[model samples]
Target: MTESNDGIDRRSAAPMYDQLRRLIVEHIENDRLQPGDPLPGEHRLCDQYGVSRTVVRQALGQLEHEGLIERVKGKGTFVARPRTAESLVHTLVGLYEEVERRGGHVHSDILRHERITADAEVARALELDEGAPVVVLERLRHVDGDAWSLSTTWMPEDVGTHSFDVDLREASLYRLLAEQGIVATHGVRSAEATVATHEQAQLLGLTAGAALLRLRSVSRDESGRPIEFFVAYHRGDRSRFEFQLDADSSRGELIRIP
Candidate 1:
């Protein structure tokens, strides 16, 4: 057996694959491996750790499942980029604002921005009559120059007309609304797991049926009037939502899926 420089102990009670997984994780945490860096080939890893092909494969599989590495078909496995964590539990903020606050660059490509008749769902969410005129805004959001999410928002005619001429590529919608005295003071949001559609996959640079996080929300103004309703599809591999819970609260919260 080849001697392992990363301290893979065969005498320990832990399985060989787990030990290998730990070593690889350490290499990543210690900055020996950075995001997008190619991981050693399976055979090379097996030789380095004195393990069989099966053991190496098992260890690699575990790492991939944990989002530590991504394996391309023709291209070898590489360290995966870190996921962006978004706070959804306590804050009423848009993606652009949240990303920028974390020192990340955000850009948007306006896909569609026009006045449209509200559909049933849109009308209901905005508390407007069906077929009422509403502003529809669709954008493909990018983070660090990579496609990250597709967002579609509907706002009341009075509220949305002001945004038609606004440049929103690097601007926050919430901020723009605030300029017009339409601040979103509170909101309800829900998320679900979904697979990307063919069009969505193409725009987001993912294979068809790739995992996505679907988020839907409705924002209200200080006067308790609904101002905006939006649906966003985020790349699941690159996005994570965080929630803070209070165990001492007298009432537990329940999220209803619509």
Candidate 2:
């Protein structure tokens, strides 16, 4: 092992690659490197840390996998921007309201807003009979002018009729429902990892098979009746979900997802 004067201690039991990874993390955490800042190239890193090219490559690969850095084919590697953090474990807020609360802009492009027959899955989620008439609203949501999520919502025909009168591109579904005496007081939400499909990829500006976070939720009104069911796909690389757990409680409290 080559001795390193720049914090890569060859005498330590830890591996050289791991030591380098920690060093880079420290630089990022200490603000020595800011987002979009270019990192040293492989050759420069090899000389600066007195390590082999293989060690540097391993460290950079690990960092890229962890979303701390991004490597451009010709522009070299740069520090990655922070992911958008959303908390669905504590508050019942929509994406538009949440992003606006954080001083970020939010908008949506209405894709589909017509009444359609509810399929088996949508019917089950909304507690309606199969083949029942339901309102389907699809939107491609954007945050700060970047494609963020694709959301599809289903509601019973009676409740969704009010939506046709409003321009949903700039409207909030929950607020619209509230105006019609349907308020979502609580909901059950679940999240899972999924790959972007061809259609979804095109709408979200990602390649097919890219990582995505799928969020499904069933919202109930104050009367304990299911009023809304929605499925949303969020870009995994740009979005992150946060949760707060209490050791004393057996079940974690979850809020609604928009």
Candidate 3:
């Protein structure tokens, strides 16, 4: 390995492992290291940073946990390729936004996009009359060329009909809605474990019956009117969810997405 003159500063108050983690992330963000590029081994990192092996390992472990790097069993660690964006369930954000925030490429394959009569469940969720017009959009979202999510969204006719004219391959549904003066301000979401169906498995490149994380949410406008009912299927191994709660606030208990 080439000598690294940018060694950690022992005088800094920050922990060495944290400093190392920052350095690695900086390298990634700066494009000094490309995706799939192998990272220097533990020994090399130790020597380059003038730190102990334990410190090097700890830093690597943290990076792995953060999805910034991946370790191959026999091969060395490499800059991690972007998988599914780690969805924070409590946040009323869309998948496209999450992927873009992480500097990952996102594209969608529109499986179904058309106006349809609202089914009983969809009508109930949107507080619309049964058999009323509703727009349905089904897409398979990809992250860095890998299938990440299979999403199905239903919206009231007035809101969803606009989607038919929009180019969903490149446009975000939420963004399109916002353009039409429909903004989602709040949402109620739930997540559960599920088994993939044959269709889902084929689309996501997994075997049927594979474990998946299924998320359902109902988003509302500023007037508290439900605007959309959304469902997403995420690969259990590729995505993780995190939430931050205030101890003094309501529902203070911590919950993690398994």
Top candidate, metric TM-score: 1
TM-score ranking, best first: 1, 2, 3
Better of 1 and 3 by TM-score: 1
Model 1 lowest lDDT segment of ten = 1-10
lDDT of each: 0.86, 0.83, 0.82
Instruction: Please write out the lDDT profile of model 1 over residues 1-258, one tens digit for every residue.
Output: 234545778789999999999888877777677888987879889888889999998998888767788765456878988888998534789998899889999899999999999989999899999999999999999999888999999999999988977799988889998988899888888888899898998888776776788889999998999999999999877887887767775575677755
lDDT string, candidate 3, 1-258, tens digits: 437837588889999999988887877777678768988888888878789999888998888766778765457888976545465477888888888888877799999888899878898889999999888999999877878889999998888878877778876788888989999998788888898898998898766775688998899999999999988999764787876668766563444532
Model 2, runs deviating above 4 Å:
1-33, 37-61, 70-78, 252-258
Inter-residue clash pairs, candidate 3: none
Model 2: pairs clashing at backbone N, Cα or C within 3 Å: none
Which whole-number lDDT from 0 to 100 does residue 42 have in model 1? Answer: 90
Model 3: CA > 4 A from native: 1-85, 250-258
Q: Count the backbone clashes (under 3 Å) in each candidate.
A: 0, 0, 0
Of the pair 1 and 2, which is ahead by lDDT? 1
